[model samples]
Target: MKTILTAATLIATLAVSGAAVAQDFVQSGTTPTLPQREGQAIYNAVCSGCHMADGRGAEGAGAYPPLANSDFVESPDAVIAWVLNGYRAMPPLGSIMDDEQVAEVVNYVRHNLGNSYEGSSTAADVQAMRE
Candidate 1:
């Protein structure tokens, strides 16, 4: 119990102290000044950390996998599955986000990221995909 509390306290301290450093690493995305759509905003906030702002994922310990013109994303349901249930190193974001937000981000990736898929997924679709 004491060890758990200590670990939690240490984590909180590091998070507070590293907040500035974390911001420095994550502020590379396209920051929209106009009235931005929900999808774009969510990508800039969440997926951009791993998938990147350009959707061209970076190489490191097991590449983040680029979303731009990806054959993987061509199958739209795969995107939903990965985001909701996690498909390897990618964390599950379904719990953190509502259905509408998931739909927005998934649609954003499909339409943008060098993709031209003439389709969209609704919140109902995302809701159904949730684990």
Candidate 2:
């Protein structure tokens, strides 16, 4: 009887532990990292003015490209170049922001925008493209 009781207790403990592990995995699903958080904040401060808070630019005005659902942002190279050199209407901000800041902003737009791309951009990535 004692052996049976011990086995039952062990099984219960294993089941509880398994449940805890499963819960942890569920909570961690595809959440952004630290840099991505910073990137979001920076986007709110600087980029939001022209791009708008939701990344949707002025539609008819054609003042800025609508970044929210833009396919161009999916390409890391295109994003980097656009930020560095600026497009026709947008002035170049590459000179104003540091490499790290640029990366953070790019990452912010890519991840937080309506059409989000799943990847992180680093300062090194931007610097390499600059050269």
| Strongest candidate by TM-score | 1
lDDT measured at residue 16 in model 2 versus the true structure, 0 to 100: 65
lDDT of 2 by residue, 55-82 (tens): 8875323466789988869987788888
Where model 2 places Cα greater than 4 Å from the true spot, the runs are 1-37, 59-62
Q: On residues 1-131, what C-alpha lDDT tens digit does candidate 1 reach at each position? A: 99888778867754663463355334324532212248888787677766777899865435788998888888678888887888888888776667777888889999998997878988899877763
* Alpha carbon lDDT at 86, candidate 2: 83
* Clashes in predicted model 2: 0
Give the number of the best model, judged by lDDT. Answer: 1
Local lDDT at 55 for model 1: 90
Q: Where's the lowest-lDDT run of ten residues in candidate 2? A: 27-36
